[model samples]
Target chain A: MSLSVRHILSVNDLTKKDCALILKTAQNMEEISERSVKKVPILRGKTILLCFFEPSTRTRTSFEIAAKRLSADAVNISSVGSSLSKGETLLDTAKNLEAMNPDILVVRHAQSGIPHLLAQAVDCPVINAGDGMHEHPTQALLDLMTILKVKKRIAGLHIAIIGDILHSRVALSNIILLKKMGAKVSLAGPASMIPLGIEQFGVPIFYDIRKVIPSADVIMMLRIQREREADSFFPSLREYSRFFGLNKETMKHAKKDVVILHPGPVNRGVEIAPEIADGEHSLILDQVTNGVAVRMALLYLLCGAKK
Target chain B: MAEQKLLMTEAQMDKAIHAMAEKVIEDGLSEAVLVGIKTRGVPLAHWLARRLAQITRKTPKVGELDINLYRDDLSEVAEQPIIHKTDIPFSVDNSGIILVDDVLYTGRTIRAALDALIDFGRPKFVRLAVLVDRGWRELPIQAEYVGLTIKTKIDEVVKVMLEECDGKNEVLLKEHFSKRT
Candidate 1:
């Protein structure tokens, strides 16, 4: 009942109970979207700052919409137009925003742990929209909400995460969260793209996507982050697409009711086929829709905790 | 330590619900729909719905409302308000609604419920019913149907437990005891 946890920086910071509570609260938040008048007055007097150091369309817009739907004032500050471009430090930028009296600071940065450092520097609450290759906690939470909505449960399910695991914060957050909730998690991709010591996380590593697909209840396809890659992890995107990318052949290996998920800006032919991305099995857009509700729950929970 | 107080027993609460059901008939609300405030109010609403069905031979529509998002004192209540489901399957347009709850305290909850109910649709008229009415009315609100009325200090807690939820049917009063210095 305390709900004293003020920041959502990583899925690693959440317990199983915390996860369940969030899912339940998000279920409540989803009801507001179904109403004719979707806006709520809970956050009418509150101001939220969306500070992004990296470029984004979906996550940023989803957070903005979530804040607006909650009747909170949402202001977007990107690095391209901000003082960070003028050689200002993250602390200085954050301190300045704190001076403006924002109730919540939702941050996305290219460098991991910036949100954490900002949370420590500011008195108000901080929610990690995404921090580098570290974790996208809200993405993971919305993924959970989507899976729970589609499959009705998370425990005792085979959830296969495919593609670019090393560079994907979505993959890492989902892996930790699914494992915590008693799901069987498996990661498969080009061998070079698989992070070392990932086996220590207790999920099986598979080189062949075909081997993991037949047993997977939920197939989560992670986007190939080419911008973040310093060196090529594969011979070519075509070969990687043919072998590991989910296509018609790979779909044959999956279960009849397998739910396919992708944290998007998807490489239509690389990580997932265009058909599967838009098919009945896809929860990609559901994940996007649930993202707003999950974020609304996070903002409501975290900001309400502030003195 | 403060001694515990029992306000109502299971059978007494059942009789009270029947009486409230009869009050609905007396008020010419045979076509009325019941909307429960979330958590405790939900079970009480269903209980009253069943009682009304027996009294009128027609089951009233039932719904659940969660007022967390409409609450004015969410910051004062808890660090984070635990939001639950707000489900009203039937339309509220031009229909009479009897908002049901377990305990009516400061009337702020009823006020919030009123705000939340409006978001669905405009109702012809909305009425209030509660299992208990412990007075500390911060807002100008009063229940039309109340099972029991108890006077108590501000620090005392009133709890209504339904068998559907808490595995019992009883009303309890617990006085808060501050730690000795």
Candidate 2:
């Protein structure tokens, strides 16, 4: 089949076929990772613009690397360093960059649906690196890639996403992708932090981590309460960690071979215990490596490399 | 036995290749690598890479690949007794890889080549180059660097004869008949 992707504004924008193509392409890209001189020239003349309105160390750098590996010239535009400081509107800035005729625009905005709006305005393909608390499609894709590499299949796997569901785009995107891939999903967090209507996504919800930890094949821990304390989302970090964190005692309830995932900048002793994050079941580092592959697949498909 | 009539003469092939080389240079073919899809494509890749080196003052890395295992029709087609050698010495990662082929027929070969190429390393980019794109594609395939696009009927067969195999370089169209019919 021809590989053509116009825009990737949301995780929902991807169909099962698109997902399969990306996964298959990623599998192929993985071989390059094993080689000594890792690189490809599939996008020699293409230009990719990385426009970030928020601060990010991982997503921004990963995308830049991915684009460079594809042989595309990548230009980074952070809100702090760019003309946005001069009071340029998001649309105006986007149009200014669009005038340069970049083949793809990799954008991360603080507001949800900004990437969608930018995609509608520009002729070039737009990739959502992250958008507010709504979704992080690429992160989810990489996470799925990591899971697929480890487990081999997504269908019927019981995955539990623990902590801060209300504020995590990663959590939301993971739930959508996992559910679509036929995995049974469950959310565990403090009742105050879990969104009210999330049950409509067809996954079960739980307030007590102990109740659901045993049945989970994959335990994905979100960043702790203190991570969101800057926004005043939680009152006390210690109390939150005591109740919802993945400690040694709570882990005893989990299956022997349960895989653990965390979207990093991980809180050392807060949401996830150190042992679990660095333990036998940890697939965290693999997720980072897979991020490049998944992004490469996305760029290739978006750039019409499949023909 | 019917005699083989030349479809593309040596002069025509040279002229087309010269034009292709010029376009590659104009399109900034620096840091480019040529990867041929097995058997016939290997010679074409070497030939183009040599030409590109002559023009650019840099010899592009040339790699030969066999995509038999990656073919989509492996399940349908009867197994072949022997497989060809595949050798890609340099990393394709982050480099511009030009996939060279002699003829673009059903596109199944290109599909298999793609699967095989990705197994080595992801190039920074990939583009297709075909000496002859004879129309009868069963899959969606197009050549980015096309030497010629020949329009032919479903029953007609376009044969590519390189000096490495045939005595001279040329392309020929052959007609075949079934004895049972």
Candidate 3:
């Protein structure tokens, strides 16, 4: 079957069939990750370029490793200490890199839609790592993969996304994805942190975290992105933790078999209690492991066309 | 329209698979494992493994290899090729592996499969087994155990249907028909 879709700009860009295809391909990639050799010659001689206009350790490193594991040469270009710091425009930077003839460009930017912009400018396949508050397609895909591994299916499960929805690309992407796959999604966090008109997505919205957790099959604890929020979205971190934080007390309200997910670098004790984050229910680390495989699937599918 | 010609009935296909299994057993490949290249090869591998078990009373290990990533025509074939899972649960190191497939033709798929299989581990020795060996080899690859041989034009398609996947067991050859003026 031909890969009809070219770029992974947003989760919404993919159909349900595309999502199923990706998840299935990711399972194959996971097998490779488990192998002792842990490398494939599929993408031999291909060049993968990672362009992070924003600072990121996990997403960037995962994409780099995914490329390397597939036998592709990976080159990283960050805004800091790069020619961008010397007053080069984003388009100019991307165009110069395109001159180098990379097979795929994986980009993460602070401003939204930069990945889409670069994809439009470049000839190679462009992947959105995380683009501002717009969407993090790969992150959402990885999250879905992890959930599928834990829950066995995405449909008919209640997934509650808690925290920093106003500034979270993960929340937005996951909301679109999980709903498309037939999961019932609910958003819970401080009212100030929840974006207006988000209820139009059709899932129930709750300001009380305790009220939402009891029925949730999965609870995704998002990092309280204080850096992104100019004014305090809540009164303080302590109050936010008191109401929205997933602590042992709040944990009792969740289902016994409920799986806990955190798109990390988690602010321990702020968004989630250390006990809960490190608890048996937590698949945070599994999410990290699945991220590499999911990215590998994306890179393999997209880069094959480029070759 | 391409007209399909039935080459092997359900019972005949079963007999061919049984014969191929008997060949492997008679060759004394007790430590041999069967790895099927994905889609049709997967079911053929499992069926052959079962036949081998029935003959020798010992089941050989079975694995699957998806060569979509290793295909040379990947860029030319489709904008996006559906990737199937390659699951080799056991170690292939130092073990004899019989690569199973439904039909062998241009040998490109076998070459891709070989490239993919070697990446997992270096097998002691590798052999190819197929239900039908269709002519027109584009590469030096050849199947060691063949149930039957068929001559066909380059444009014709050979399809293998298995009860496990396709709800039928048969091989059909469809002759490609160019649009008539």
Candidate 4:
């Protein structure tokens, strides 16, 4: 099976068939982590370079682990501050990195389109780890994999995405991916935090979290990205939690089996209550595990050719 | 234009498998686990188990392996190779492991399979079985039990279509350029 595009830059870039194939491949990859000999010779003699321009604990490590598990040599290069706002440095950096001749390039940057720019600069395949307020395609794919592992399907499920919609690449990617896969999506957050003209994407936008609760089979919480804000979007974290945060009380209004998802650095009591973050309904840890499998699938699909 | 030849019909394929089962029974290796290579070998392994059970009054163990990750030409394949499930649930140590496949050609696949199998556990011993052995092996490998031996050109391909996988049990020989979907 083949993905529609060689470089997965955005969820909008993938067809529903592409999404299904990725999830299926990720399922096959999940089995490898269970074996005593977790490493495979699949990506042997291949090199994968993970370039992160932002601080990330899970996504970078997951990609590294996935590359290693497939027996590919992974090298990590990151900077504390490499925001794409710097004009020619982005392309210059990309040219220098690709000169290293890695078989594949996995990139995460504070600015959107860095992965796209690098893909064009480099001869190898490029994977978008995450980019500012634009898309996190792999995270969305892993999120879909985790959802399918539990629900067994994505269609017809009501998935309510709450919080930081204005700054979350995860939310945008999830909304696009889920809607394409036949799931009904609802966006909920403070009016200031929910970006204007996003209803053009056609999902219902709600200011009151209670209105989205009853029918929501899955509640995806987005971290309020303070780093990207020059001026605070919302007045206070306390006020945001009081309204949109998912806790035990909010659980009552949702479907009895409603699952919770957070693209983490969970603000603890801010976006989601700690109990629910660690609860049975949480697919958080599973999402982290599936992240590795999904990255493996992507690397195989893009870079697994010998020629 | 490329040519196609019907090498074995459904009945002929069954009879061939039956003969191979007889060989395994004659060798008293029917108790060994039948571990099939991916795609077609899986069904052949199950078929061998059924015949072994019918003749010996006890079913043998069965497992499936997908050797995509173990292939030497990972970079040579045109399209990306999708990794399939390699589920060998039983312990391979101290148990006889009979590697099964549909056709044995270059023998490189068997070399990869041996590497894949050893990673699971050390088998007491290992053996190979195949439905067809088309000559022109690129590696120093041979099958212990072969149903058919056909001398062929390098450009010809042998395909085994089984009932479970392709809705038929037949073998076809085709010029490699036309390929088989």
Candidate 5:
């Protein structure tokens, strides 16, 4: 098989064969991730650049950790400290970075399709960390790894993704992967917050949480709209919590072994009740551990390090 | 070249597995456990447990161990070794353990498997079972119960195909030939 994937721009571009290869590679990478000497010399002479136009903690740190573990030099350029704030177009900034001959470029921007444009402008591989609400491919891959670690299989499973479906790139990417893996997915939230015509993704949509919680093998609660972004989406926090929040009582309807998940900076009682988030079935911390493995796999594959 | 014939058919393999289950029950083994060593061993262990259930009217716990990292020739064989999941839902402490595998050849894989098993917990007694044993022992280890034993030279490969995976049940030996110089 040819090992040539220069850019990872969206989840839709991943085929079932591609998915299997990545998952199998991630399974191998997990062994190296657990060791005390976690660094590898696979990309010892390579350089990876991270250009984040938006603020992030997990996505940025995870990519940096992944690059460093592969023994690759990483450069972090934030818009706040870079010359781009003084009116340099994204293309010009990318062109400048290209001059340094970095082997890989990981970019995150608030505008959708920015990474695709960057990939076109550069000769090296480009990875889209998150491009607006379009897609977050690595996060979705890590989530799949987490699910497989716990459930042992992904097909024929039911996963309920609740809260802020319209604003969450995580939910969008996850729905694509879960459906591709043969899992039945359902979206539950207020009608306004759920995107219209998403049934094309083959996910059933529900406005009531009570009706959907019973059949879920995995309940993934997305972060509620940030307080600053709430004014345009929801009327009040209390009403949203009452309608969609996952509480102890609401969890009883789910399968006994159902796992709870969240992409953090949680809204506490608003998106998911605190009890269930920290409860026995939650694989939240396991997802974080698998994030490193998945990112390592992504970098290795994109860097053509696969054997 | 030597011709290799079928020593055990699919029906005979099933019968031997059931007889092993009866032996496990007659031994008065309690808290019995079956641990398979990665890829092919996992399915064999599951099959043994199913037969054990039919004989004892109780299911023995099953676990899977991946010994990729513990392999003796890991660095020499592949640059990036593949690892599979190791799942043991129940503790192995004081349990009567049966280590299952599809085929036992040079026995180095079983040696690596033994080292991997100790990391989980100490079992009361560890026994070995194989569906087919091709005679070429690099170590002194032997299977307590074997479905069939095939005698072959170093220039042949024994292949076992199971219905659960390959949609058939048979054993074959393919002669290895070097290309003309």
Candidate 6:
């Protein structure tokens, strides 16, 4: 079956059934990695263009790998190397990329709604890799997949999202997806790190990480957005880690079998302690592995639909 | 809408399966690894394994292969092919592998399955087995073991309904007129 929506710009728009379909399909795609020949012929002869205006490591590489594994020709066009550097606007760049006739487009930009904008301008479907601090749907999906493998379920589970919620696209996407799947999500970070109006989303907020830790079945530690470091959400990294960082003491309060998740490039002792990040409870590596599978599923679904 | 005509009754199906089991036994069953193409082929593989066990008192390894990723007409098909797990726990490098399917038509699906199977490992030998071989093949592929041979037109559909998935045991032929026709 195909995805009902044309563009995956945000998790706010996906239904629970949509999420379930994607996760199931991703499980099937995960097997490709274990094969001696890690490639499929499903998307053969199709071209997938990756347009990234922002600097990224995992998301860009993950999408490219997923496309290639499916035997789809993957073309990367970053803002620096492309015509966008030659005085072309984002819209003009998108139109020119469309002229080449790519089957699906994966986009990442510094500003939010860029994928939404390109989806309207292009005939093919658009998958948002990460559009500012608005949402990173694929990251949330891979997190859910990882959690499912360990915890066996998402419904009725307490998930505490710690650190830099105010600027985390991962936290927002996870909150929306977890809520949709009937999971209890709470925010734990410094006061300034918690986004305002998040209470309207019906999730409780905790300034003290310890308070949220006891009931949390899953602890999702978010990276402190260092690029936005000039804002100074906390007094210093030293104070932030002491109060909100997930150390051995924090782990004691958490569920005995609690699973930890982080969406890449973690600031070791800032959002999470080194011991906890690399410890038995951590699924940090699994999240990265699942990212490729989740992307492959989305590409197959979107491209297979009536374009 | 079209009415279905019963091609094989429950007792007739048992006889057809027995014939298939005898053919596998004759073809060398000691090193056999039965791999079912996903959806209907899975149960067909299990049934053959059980029957083979009854005769030779040895149960062969049964595996499931999903050919969705290897389909030749993936982009041209209207609906997206749903992917399923392709789990072959045993080694395929040097074993007699029998590819099982419920109904064989067009021969393209078997061609796709062959492409998917080879990626797992190099098999000692590979053979094709089908419960029904409807003769309208688009490719040169042929099944080594067949339970029943039926002539079919382009507008007809051959459906094998079993208890494990479809809650019945019978073979039916129906006329299905879609946009393709």
Best by DockQ: 6
lDDT of 3 by residue, A250-298 (tens): 9888899999999999899999999889999999999999999999888
Task: Provide the lDDT at A10 for model 3.
Answer: 88
Query: Among these predicted structures, which one has the highest TM-score?
Result: 6
**Candidate 2 vs candidate 5, DockQ winner:** 5
User: Relative to the true structure, how large is the alpha-carbon lDDT of every model?
Assistant: 0.90, 0.81, 0.88, 0.87, 0.81, 0.89
- Going through the candidates in order, state the TM-score of chain A alone for each one: 0.97, 0.96, 0.97, 0.94, 0.96, 0.98
Per-residue lDDT of candidate 6, residues A162-241 (tens digit) = 88998888999999999999999999889998888998888999999889998889999989888977238778889888
On the 0 to 100 scale, the lDDT of residue A148 in model 2 is: 86
Off by over 4 Å in 5: A1-4, A305-307, B1-181
TM-score of each: 0.93, 0.68, 0.93, 0.93, 0.66, 0.97
C-alpha lDDT (0 to 100) for residue A119 of candidate 2? 88
Question: What's the lDDT for residue A184 in model 3?
Answer: 99
DockQ of 6: 0.80
Candidate 2 lDDT (Cα, 0 to 1):
0.81
Clashing pairs in 1: none
Q: Can you give the lDDT of residue A273 in candidate 3? A: 93
lDDT of 2 by residue, B1-181 (tens): 6444567888888777777777888889767889988777888888888788889888888998867435444224332212345678887677789999998989988987886678676878888898889888888888888888978767666777788867678888766532200
Task: Give TM-scores of the second chain, every candidate.
Answer: 0.94, 0.91, 0.94, 0.95, 0.87, 0.95
lDDT of 1 by residue, B31-70 (tens): 9999999888999999999999998889999999988888
Error (Å) of candidate 3 at residue A27 is 1.8
- Where's the lowest-lDDT run of ten residues in candidate 5 chain A? A34-43
DockQ of all candidate complexes: 0.67, 0.05, 0.54, 0.62, 0.08, 0.80
